[model samples]
Target chain A: MRNVKGPEIKSVEDLIGPLARVRPGRPGGEVSGTGARTLLASVTAEEPTGRTAGDVPVPAAVRRYGLRRLTLGAAAVVLAAGFVVGPSLLEDGSGGAASYANSAVAIEREGGDYVARIKDPFAEREEFGEAFAALGLKVGLNLSPASPGAVGEIFRVGTSGGGVGRGFVAGTEPSGCSPSEPGCVMVLRVPADFTGEAWIELGRQARPGEAYRNHGSAVGRYGELRGTDVDGRPVEEVLAEVRRRGLQVEFQRIIVGDGGSLSFEAVTAGEVGPAWTVWDAEAAMAGKVRLMVTPEKLDDNPMYEPGLGPGGLDDLGESDEPGKSGEPGRSGGG
Target chain B: MSDDRPARFEAVYREAYGRITAYAARRCDSPQDAADVVAETFAVAWRRVDELPKGQEAVLWLYGVARNVLANHRRGETLRRARSAGLDAEMADLYAAPADRGVEMSVIAEVFRNLSEDDRELLSLVAWEGLEREEIATMMGLSRNAVRIRLHRARRRFSRALAAAGVPFGMERRMVPAGRSL
Candidate 1:
């Protein structure tokens, strides 16, 4: 008789399968160590008075939650498909139960706002997305691995691109979620009267000295001006526009060498603002770049597009390629 | 129920300890973290012993609990810093620092890291946890259909990524089974 088999093993599965099998083993010894005994003792001593895992009754909130979830799923699909669903089509009325609980998060009506108890901060991003979606608000919390100092800590909170509302900020940490606690739960309060899309970034601390990548850049800090038109325009015209906007302007004359190579030198023209602009007529022909124009001088260089890095223009001195602009403000002498 | 809690917890603990340790060890950066994950998971089980299911179900449920605990730990929420000296020492026993995966494995790991967190989690649940679709649905609080759809998409994305990275791997049937069509 021929053996009947299930579906064929997939390639993706084949690749990752070994990661599961070969795990780092714990050092072997008696399992009943003091840590074990202490934990057992603590459990024994503490009052066992809470609902069991997955035992909470499905509350009426699930009904209201259902429609919101349906809408959210539709919105996500539409967005993922690259079809822009208007905000009006996604509008949801707010009137969820005062208290809602999930494995990932818990919500309780507090004062005029809703207090979200983040039960598992390290829960997958979709889980957080679902929890917030159920509450009939476009809010999200993104927790990711971070350096030890920033771990489990709220590093920074601000509105991200095209989010729902303004004035959203991190409130106090929930009493239950201390830094030392396993499964720290954080409490976030959104305005009771406010509803719309919002997001917050949370940090998960990596093991001490573990290499953690910081993808955040200090780009677009004050503002930015870029594009071929913006760069092609005369330096004086750009500065005039900056002055029109009631902002300070600092221009660097990008000088072109006689060999047709580009370089940057500070604009020392007291009247037009930099001297190189007057001396090097060919400089303006190369590119009329507005290197820096902020309300105030920045501590670090402003963030710029990565493509700009090839020309040696990103605020961070990451590129070492020749013909690229040197550090912000300091010019590569022509 | 009270009288049975300790024995029940102990029995399940012995049976599943290594698996849970492996689960956490594979994901965690250090043995201490894995130990803490194990300790917290069992501690939770003991406190809620009455709710645990019978036989293999309890093991599955424990896996669910450990999953959440690990998530919280990864988010850097340290609960119970003062775990008994003994527990700390025991946890340290579980700590084996990760050795470098030489070139090929490292390349695979890099490409895998490049995938979305959701994709990685879906693939890992299948590859690392060995969870079937339905089991993954239960653990992740998604419907079985959702799990299947996501798994398929995740697989497709991984395949594309691998191909883009110039990795040689097998191709599985791309179409969903008849009844499971999305």
Candidate 2:
């Protein structure tokens, strides 16, 4: 047997005897901590309640989750086959869960080829405008609505003829009512090949002693987004107050650079912590893209897709019986 | 007797569920992900309930099912790293100061992520699951002696990996820390 040595091992699935009794009315379902953790606030480590360790797989389990999972497996096979695509059409930030039915879309098929004119169940909705306004931070759009916690889709952004697609974005944090310290803020991320960059600009009130000079060109900036006091006001009022404070945002022009290099980055600037959480999968960011737009210039304009209205994310596969009560229930007490 | 079986199954589920959960938490990186392995493992047993051996033997065999399920879990761990649209903007910095009440969790998770899936699972089997080499052998289909040797190696490896990952190393695997209650 090719053995596992002291240094070659990583983790193990241990089995301790059961704890406590659930007899009669006893609340035998207590789930004390088991030491598993997730860095992203939304990525929870649930318990495997109502299930055991000595189990096997059968047809029913597969049939229930087959369609959704099959899609993912199919995607994996495509990427593994080295089929890469451009980021130009990656993010569809039209608006919440809106659908353009029976429309022909694009796909990266096996052997790294583009399968054009393929019909998608739905085209991603672009709601970055509403999301930007709702969060009250100045950022750029390069997003679309898709379920990551459920069945994740793919998104690739970069000038490299071949782009990397991480699939989806899910998980959100509680929204903030004000732009105070430690609150969530809205931010936009863009690839160097951004055309919207030149059109982008920033606007925020700069404090007297709170210098913005030390910060190099806005691309590599790291500031606390110091806010002005909007005493005891509603969230919308605070949004308006912040906008009137002039422009403090850094501007950038998205330009596809040399060597056919592919770079990725995330823009975290919002009052809501999860607002900054692009997806629960990756952390930090890498690149040299400049920030653009002030809070005022930041469009509080249309949030719906270029055509659709609100209620986009509503009723999407919600009735799909997510993690059913009986199909091998997992402990939600993560 | 027909009525007796469902009651018995419920009893078994109640007694063994948390144990399996604890076992999975130690080995798998995230509870939800670990729970997937655990749930799948137990669902197999439940479907093939009649095939399970009697008494303590059954417990040991359950460990075998968990082993296989975890193997499946490890294979898919790579998917968790794929790039996403909002990952940079949304995901909290893994190295930043953990602001909330999950420091122990973050530290443990960080340590867990750094370890290879194999070491983490075998050690968690012993420490978190409290399985003996003999029982583990039955579940994994290995010889008893081989189980002992493998378990020992797994434990040793876990210690070194934990140390390198900055987890409290001097402490034993069985020593449950103050934060991870139950």
Question: Which candidate leads in lDDT?
Answer: 1
**In candidate 1, what are the lDDT values of residues A242-313, reduced to their tens digit?**
444453433444443343343454544363432112111111111122343322322222222223222322
How big is the positional error of residue A201 in model 2, measured in Å on the Cα after superposition? 85
**Each model's TM-score, in the order given?**
0.37, 0.31
Evaluated with DockQ, which candidate comes out highest?
A: 1
B14-66 in candidate 2: lDDT tens per residue? 55555666555545544577667666666666555555554455655566666
lDDT agreement of model 1 with the native: 0.47
What is the iRMSD of the candidate numbered 2? 20.2
Q: What is the lDDT, from 0 to 100, of the residue A141 in candidate 1?
A: 74
Q: Candidate 1: which stretches are off by over 4 Å?
A: A1-10, A20-47, A51-334, B77-100, B171-182
DockQ of each: 0.07, 0.04
> For candidate 1, lDDT tens digit of each residue in B1-182?
47766777778776676667667766665667777887777767666676765565566677778877777775554455454556776766686523754465656677887999789878876666666554565455453324544665677688788778877663333311111111
TM-score, chain B, model 1, is 0.74
